[model samples]
Target: MTTLLIRDGVIDDADQIAGVHVRSWQAAYRGLIDQEVLDGLSIPDRAEGWRRNLSDPLPTIIGILVAERDGEIVGWTSFGSGREEEGAGDGEVYGIYADPAEWSTGVGRALLDAAEQRILDAGHTRAYLWVLDGNERADAFYARQGWVADGASKVEERPGMSLREHRRVKHLAGS
Candidate 1:
């Protein structure tokens, strides 16, 4: 494995990030989410959205980081202030995804570590993220990283189905 570089994401990374996002979702959420929804994901559309967000992020958005290996983007994460009215922490990891081909290659872990450090540097002592209820892979990964499910859950409405998600929290103090 080559060195994995974690860096702040720029607008130019939108296309690659979108590609990873869509591919990761298609692979990771296969049986957990509606097939139609996954099949309908458009890379171009996601790229445009990412482009806009990276270029002009909202105040709540703290940062976006990308993991690159051998000059290719293999994963990315976005983090920011908590969006929920009664969040478990002051900071939240909005999203994290690694290219399907790169799973277990430490890309996800690297990106996550960087996000956690960023949150800590921003003075947040704790942070949380939502994982699809049935995503055992993600659950195990987070567990290995010292995150625990906080028993909070919600149903998300999708095109043809309702998906459930659970919240996981990690204390960042003294880490």
Candidate 2:
């Protein structure tokens, strides 16, 4: 319930961000995804990837933002130029992950609001995101925020299995 701060991510926050990323998936996807696969997620590996991402961001990755409560990173979301795989749009929220303890605390929602604004600030008129097909909590959250499923889907390989992901889109007012 304290003030939640959202800010641009920096390389120094990689470790904390990684911690949240892995733990969040473990919690959020516990029943939704394969237990073994979720258990296999490594914080160190995630941190290394985040370090590379924050340290040497790609040109298309416009922003990576983190959510902090009392000075600790508890959530993050990254958005950028839209992926070629989606409907005609100029932006995409690659992901938003939060520490399990922080779930339902409004941090994820706040992070999403910030990501959308950042997308619009970058001159994107529409934005889209891919969410795991069966993540009911996420699906409902996105729906409440006005995102609609666009009937697009993809199967991605993960830990020796295939997982289905669906797309959601929203049009910005200025579009």
Candidate 3:
């Protein structure tokens, strides 16, 4: 059995987190994302983005929870205050990714649970996230966890192309 633990990411986790983000996006977004957009993804670019997020002072409390197997980081989840104007009552899961080797090993689930708990503890009423429209696997996963789509779609750009993403939300206790 693999023992998994979640911890707050430190400043030094930028590189590791960026690598995980890029690899996971490539794996999870393969067929659903435009090839031209995915082609421009780079670890260095993502690292810089993460660095800025981590440096933000307020409203954007970015935290990276790492899933480790035998002391090796295999997956990560990032959560922060919602970016939308009205939905600030809940934290949003902006990024989630895991190593393909650790997929379905409960890593993603555990990370989400931890993130949601943190959000709730921080007084959030619920949690929400954006998922690309054609990501059936991800949609099913979120549905299984009690998330519901709000029938809203927004255009999102990766690097070279734009795609539509659906907003999904899960109500927390006392929401």
The candidate maximizing lDDT is 1
Off by over 4 Å in 3: none
Model 1 C-alpha lDDT per residue in residues 1-175, reported as the tens digit of each score: 7899999999999999999999999999999987889999999999999999999998888899999988888999999888887873589999999998999989999999999999988888899999998899999999999999999898878667787999999899987
Candidate 2 per-residue C-alpha lDDT over 42-151 given as tens digits, one digit per residue, 9 for 90 to 100: 98999999999998988889899999989999899998988765454578999999898988889888999999998999888888998987799899989988899998
Candidate 3 local lDDT, residue 98: 86
Ranking by TM-score: 1, 2, 3
List the global CA lDDT of all models. 0.92, 0.88, 0.81
Candidate 3 displacement at residue 14 in angstroms? 1.6
RMSD for all candidates, in order, please.
1.2, 1.5, 2.0
lDDT of 3 by residue, 1-175 (tens): 8678788776677777788888888888898877666777899998897777666634676566887778777788888789878676678897788887777889889888888888778777788899988999889988888889999789976456787899999988853
Worst 10 residues of 2 by lDDT: 82-91
Each candidate's clash count: 0, 0, 0
Q: Return the TM-score for candidate 2, rounded to 2 decimals.
A: 0.94
